[model samples]
Target: MNLIAKLLPAIALTAGLSAAQAEGDALHGKQLYAVRCAICHSLDYNGVGPTHKNLIGRRAGSVQGYAYSPALKNSDVVWGEANLKQWLSEPEKFIPGQKMFIAIPDARDRADIVAYLLQAGAQQPSKTP
Candidate 1:
């Protein structure tokens, strides 16, 4: 076999994996959210937790009508991908004394959830309180 032939399979596999990782599976993410986060959160309005409608770009603890922990309310954190990943990995560790206790141990799962939130937020119209 030529060198090009030997390299083709490896290159193809690498490309496929990279593409898969680059964009998360939003459908799977929605399912994960339903199972893991729906009880505490909602897309359109505040539930036990704050509304997740426009969570990605919104500042921490800025959701209207929902009471937030002082630690989170005071923290100057913006909800971007990196911050979301860190927060999901360990909420307490990210923001000490915050009310959230759930932690998604798997990095891939966290990524998926964040992707779902991003996609969902984009699909829905913004709600003004």
Candidate 2:
């Protein structure tokens, strides 16, 4: 192999590794959920807010007992990354008279939280033997 041919394989390998790293460590939103969101939202049980065990890809107002605001309950918006982003940016703006109080100031943080929620939602429960 010529010098360029030998170097090409190395370059491709480096790029592939970088892409995989990005996917693996790209759970930025989890940090936001831990610090900013855990106070209100719980993963398996209802805290001040409802549980988020499977928030993403679920229907709005679908959780069994928690009473959502009329504005939120009436809407047909599906819970996903895009809707979560908007809701995090400004809860009041997204649904007037909603109970959530804080606004997410950073867009990147919101994106990270969304990614974390989705990943967490997808996890299967481990059985204890």
Candidate 3:
């Protein structure tokens, strides 16, 4: 009984930690994408940055016609939840030789942007400033 009482709190804490990993809201994500990501990226096509369309699961630097830094071009990184989150959190640190100068900074904002990117290709981008 004594050991079980102590273990209960640990179990509760573990459950709380797991519950913190919630999926971002795609709608709010769209708004975040517009304000933060649209300056250089798009769901439709590439401009200063590569398109986010089909980004998930794609190998880094694989978009056709977009010029990429040699480090990115030669990278083995794949765009998935974990790597994408890290990349958004800190670009230069994520890929040392790459030249991205921006970061989303907030974990929620990053999740929202990533959620938006995952779904934006199937819907029109929301207008935002």
Candidate 4:
């Protein structure tokens, strides 16, 4: 009974932390994307970078028409929360020799950006240009 009581608080804390990490604000993410990513990327077409529509779960460097670096094009990473977080934190470090150099240092901001990307990607129509 004493062991259970001691373990219960730790379990509750772990659950709370997980919930907090998962609860990213998509609205904030949208704003952050505009400031940080808009210069190089778009949702509907390939600009300086590839379209971000339907980005999650898509394989890295798989978007058509955007010229990708050899390192990125060859990498077999599937986009997901973990991968996105690492990429956002440090793109060059995540995939060496990739063209993208932008990095989001704040973990919370990175989470928000990923959340926004997921939400925006879902809403936007996929386009190729």
* Whole-model lDDT per candidate: 0.87, 0.77, 0.82, 0.88
lDDT by residue (tens digit), candidate 3, 1-129: 999999999999988866644677678888888888889997678989998777877889998999999989888998887788899999989899897789988898888777766665433445799
Better of 3 and 4 by TM-score: 4
**Over 4 Å off, model 2:** 1-26, 123-129
Q: Which stretches of candidate 1 lie over 4 Å from their true place?
A: 1-14, 123-129
Q: Give the residue spans of candidate 3 off by over 4 A.
A: 1-21, 121-129
| lDDT: worst 10-residue window of model 4 | 118-127
> How much RMSD separates candidate 1 from the native structure?
3.1
Give the alpha carbon lDDT tens digit for every residue of 3-41 in model 4.
999999999999997886686778889999999999989
Against the true structure, candidate 1 reaches a TM-score of 0.83
Model 1 score (lDDT): 0.87
Worst 10 residues of 1 by lDDT: 118-127
1 or 3, greater by TM-score? 1
- lDDT tens digits, residue span 1-129, model 2: 699998999999999977754443335567667889898888898777888877767777677888887777887888887888899899888878777889888776776677788788654556699
Give the per-residue lDDT digits (tens) of candidate 1, residues 1-129: 699999999999999988977777677889999999999999889998898887877899998899999999999998887888899999999999899989999988888888888878653554699
Clashing pairs in 2: 29-112, 29-113
